[model samples]
Target chain A: MTKIVVLVKQVPDTNAKIVVSGDRVDLSAVKKVMSPYDEFAVETALRHRDASGGEVIALTLGGAGADKVLKDAKAIGVDHIVRIDCEEELDSNSLQSALASTLQEMGAEIVYCGKSAADTGAGSTGPGVAERLGWASASNVTSVGFDGGLTVVAPSDGGNARMSVNTPAVITCDKGDIKVRKPNVKGIMQAKKAQVEVKTAAIQPSSVTIVAHSMPPAKPAGKSYEGGAAAAEVANLLRDEANVI
Target chain B: MTELIVIAEIAKGTIHTTTSELVTAANALGGSPIIIVPCTDASVADAAGTIAGASKVIAAKSDAFAHYDAAAWAEALDAVAPQGTILTSATPQSKDLAARLAARRNLSVVQDVVAISQNQLTSPVYSGKAMQTVAISGPAVVSVRANVFDAAPSTGSNEISVVDTTGNMATAVQEFMARASQRLDVAEANIIISGGRGMGSPDNFVHLEAIADTLGAAVGASRAAVDTWEAIPHSMQVGQTGKTVNPNLYIAVGISGAIQHLAGMRSSKYIVAINKDADAPIFQHADYGIVATWEEALPVLQSTLAGMMA
Candidate 1:
């Protein structure tokens, strides 16, 4: 059986009215959900588990609030979970180390994660983990399937770049693969009873940290270009005025 | 004076344009750069010799070192950094290498750093949302985001010193599948028109395509736009991890600029946003914004520009 670990994060649900105060994400009015891309990892894991007959484990470096997302994962068919809960504010570097240690402890055969965190967009964590663990890794993968070995389809310049790679590798899912299927009412209730294990981070002393946060400046009002000759005016505005063309 | 190590990334047997740019930045600091090359392929080594200001070019050639691998590179760089600042391009592979090497060696790693003075350096925070200058001390490994600095002209006849790293690496690059050959990357385009999920369907992009063709602009997409895979290709995605661009003009259609998406294009000189909803985050950074559906705005704007050009 192939042991698969999907690294998921608990993020504010869709349509959450975001209020950013400094580096903290204001989650007062928002409910937590599994990060969108990480859902792809879970989906891929379940698919692998169904075919390969191994356990699928959901993992995250989050706080107690992360349990909600784990429940969601359990409803979707993940068999095991590990929440490395810590208040030390681990960046991608620290998270990578902790994940490496965790995966080594579990002896998982494969690892998967979203290309980047929706909130941080660091995109470095997954690849960083693979590097620390001495495993092959690929990002922006559009498709995947296991045939004797794992074959990952990565979108390159325009077309897809497919490579049949070995196990003990890390792959990050991009958007637009298959959307996550909603858990049935029965599945949700069953998931509420699933077991969850929490762990603490093992590394400290990060090289990067969030210094502060600020909103981007407002865009200027757009002027509507009327019909006919105005098209030429718009063209000129785009070329000579905006110097974009 | 401290010694500096520069890994001059050469692709397809030639030095990337940013090679000279990095050397120019390194020259301002205290150290004389010791150039490191993973592949000692003759053509790339000869090209390395032409970089104007480098003190010495160190070349390591092998099939294992041909393609960019973060693990192998980090290990190799760790051995080379005992001397000076180990500077690398902020390209995808370079960032990974720098981060892994720094983490492995427990050395200080500064990434996407734009300008470096003697003690203070400027780096973009929140994906170019704002620039922060910080003071630093000690042995540092830094990766420079290529576009942030000017591509220094290659004019000097610097000396080339080749080094052997044939047996130094254990990890091998089996193969490489690069897709950047098809579409114009955001980094290189002067004009870009981006779409979001609000554009609705893939066919709707044709309207924006007409305008882009008229203006000779490239097509781009937000992560949401790319989510509709049928409409936009993944290559054109402009966002935090996707691609960072500084185009002359950027037109965002039906896009509710998420902070992640904005991080990719906020540096454009002029930004125009078209969205039915005025409250979109994109409008906050636009030079011009129109609260109109793309279906209505795109055709009208395209025809208007076409007629005016005629």
Candidate 2:
């Protein structure tokens, strides 16, 4: 069976308000869920696994607090799940290194992950993993095609490019045309009782250090005009003040 | 001053406009920059030599350059480019390249840098909910966002050198088929018009496209629209998980401005929102707000703007 691994992350719900206090972003009050882009990745993995006989594994780094997101993936019928038990906050380099090591030890072929995590939004891990593993990777992929080999539709400079890449490759998913499936009643019960396989990786000291963290400056109370009557005025302002026309 | 090396982006066999922006960004770092053009042709390197603010241009040409394989491209470029800070555009493709180069070289890689100085780089973190500034201590690979810097003026002749890299490449990627042109990506567009589920139907996005055509803008969709309608592809989604667009003018029609959507386009210079509900969150962030249904407001707005342009 083709062994496929999906990199999953737990992020605050998209609608939750983010609060920053004392040089730290406090997401304690927010409800955590699977990162939006990863949902699409999971869907793509399941589709590929269904088409070709394979075992789909969902992997994450953070523990306990991230269990819900793993269960969420399991509830959707992923075959197995694992979480790296790491407590220290890692920089991009260290994080990528840990993930790359895990994938190598797992002997995973054709890894799938989101282009960027919703939390860091760094967009580094997927490509970084491929670089470290010395494997080919296709990112921002809108479509995946399988024709006795791996082919993917990715965003290029002007339009899209459909490229065929070798296996043991990393694929970073974009939402594309995918619609994630909702978990069924049986799957939910199975997921709630699913046993999570535990693993650990060496967390290295980070080269980069955060100087400070702060919120963006608040926008001024904007002028609201009622109805279609203000359309002409807004147009005139675009030309007169904004000069964006 | 640190030796800042710039990697020029080539799109469809020509040097991209973002390379000029990257050069201008290098100027901000208080260093002379060298341009590295990875291409199959030499004129692309000659084009980079014309982009001012760079000391020299190195054309890293290869047969493998015809397609992008992250490992192959990273190894090829790393072999030719100097052992110093690498600066390129924060564009999606380049950001991926930045990560690869940093990983291969064991250097720090900072992606999507909006502002930079001699010693530190600042970028949005946690999906734009907050901004984090990091101190640059050593050699690092930094990706600068497009449109955040001035295009370096004076396209003068700089010295150019060409080095073929097929000898250096361990080619793996194969058969790249480029589809014909589509509308501008929202991240690169100066003006954008976006629609949400509030538009009621995905087909109504064509109306948004009509206005976009009038303004030469890109059409975008909210996450809700993408999730609700299969017809709406995620490529057009402007949200926390989709794209972060910093356009000159962002017109949001039939969008209630969810926080995730706001996180993407809130950095736009001027925002104009139109929605049926009067209390929609979008009005708070919009410079000009119109309270009306898409049916009532779009036709008038498009025609009025068309008349002004004409």
Candidate 3:
């Protein structure tokens, strides 16, 4: 059976009001859920597993808040799950190292992750893991498939490029892919008993640090260009003022 | 002085316009900056020479480095920026690479920054949901979004020393494809005119395009407009997580002005909003507000302005 691993992150929902307190996200009123992009990764893995008959493993590193995501993954058809609950929040480098070690522990023919976590919008975990593990990786992929090895559709400078690669590779799923499917009633029932192993990360010397964070400035009030001829005023603003041509 | 490393991206074998903006930003931080050139293209190296504030330029050449790969970049950065902080544009490619690099270093990745200094950093949180002020606690890696800072004029002689650092990483770039566009980038445009869902159909965009053509300005859209309207190009998307712009004048038509959409163009010196709804959110941000149908309003503005131009 082809062995596949998908990296998942539990994040705040898209519509939630995130309070930026200092450099950290103020989670006081936020409701945590599986990051939306990870759903694409999980969907891609399950689709591949369904088509080629493989064992799909879901992996994550976070505090206890990530349990729901693992459960959601199992309900959605992941065969196995690993929850690496770290003592400290693993930065991207430490997370990559830990994931490399995890991938070594659970050898797989392919690995997948979301292009970015919506909450943080970091867009780094997949590439970090791929680099640390010395695996070839592709990111911002809108579509993915395994023909001889791997074929993915990714955003290029102007349009999309279909990329082909071999196995033992990493692919980060981007937006515009098919929306992820919800878990069926039977799958949800089975997910309750799915094997979940929690491990603590062991790594040192994380290079990145979040020193602070802030919100964007308020825009000055707006002035409307009414009527069909408003386009002319717009033209004037663009030429004489904005110079954005 | 501590060494500052700036990852200057070159698209299609040439230095991107954002490179000058970033180098100028680094100069404001009071340092001779180091530029990292990932591709083997010689013209890109020459363009780095034009960045008047740099002390050194490190060129890493490889087939694999040409494509935008965060993994390949992490390895390259590991080789060059082991002890120093890695800085990049807050673009999609750079955001991914910087975050992953920061994670590998076990440092926090600060993103979407509008302002940066030695002690304090300003970035948009919640996808332009709100602005937050952060302080650096450690030697951290940072990714700054384009248009966050004023372009700093070049001040030094055009001397560049090249360093090679591709030996540490063992990967090659398979390919690179550039996004094609004839209009100016939203971030680079001095004036921008945007349409919202209220523009109706893709066919109606010709009017907006005509205005844009007249002013020689770039056209943009909110997320809703991009998703629903066929008129706007994908490259002209401006929203919370989309391109950030700082034009001198911004004109919005039929847009209600959600906070997320406004954040992208809020930096524009002048803002004009046009909407039929008296209570449109856009009116809250517009310096000039006209409450009328875009179809009706646009023609009046066009004729009135055309008469003035004539």
Give the number of the best model, judged by TM-score. Answer: 2
DockQ, candidate 3, comes to 0.42
Residue A150 CA displacement from its true place in model 2, Å: 1.7
Superposition-based RMSD of candidate 2 using all C-alpha atoms, in angstroms: 3.0
Fnat value of model 2: 0.69
Tens digit of per-residue lDDT, candidate 3, span B1-310: 5566788866667767677777766765567678877765544666676566777676656555655555556776567664665678876677777766775665666676667676566765555565555665556677777655665455555655454555333223345445565665675566788888888876777777776676667788888888785546556788654566767678788788876686577766778788889888778777667777878877766665556556
- Give per-residue CA lDDT, model 1, range A23-142, as digits (tens): 544567877777777888889888888877899999887778788888888898888878887757654556677888988898888888886565544456666777678777766566
For model 3, the superposed segments whose C-alpha errors exceed 4 Å read A20-25, A87-90, A192-195, A203-215, A222-245, B28-30, B58-66, B69-83, B99-108, B132-139, B162-194, B212-251, B258-272, B300-310
- The TM-scores of all predictions, comma-separated, are 0.78, 0.90, 0.83
Better TM-score candidate (2, 3) = 2
For each of the candidates, what fraction of the native contacts does it recover? 0.15, 0.69, 0.48
Candidate 2 error regions (>4 Å): A184-186, A189-193, A221-229, B155-157, B167-188, B197-206, B226-233, B276-278, B292-300
**Candidate 2 lDDT over residue span B1-310, tens digit each:** 5688999977778888889888888878777799999998877787777788889989998876876667778888988898888987877888998999999976768888888876778888776778888887777899987767877776668899998876333224344455332677787788999999989998888899889989999999999999899888777889887789988899999889888898898878899999989999999899999998888888888898999888
- Candidate 2 Cα deviation (angstroms), residue B216: 1.5
Candidate 3 TM-score, true structure as reference: 0.83
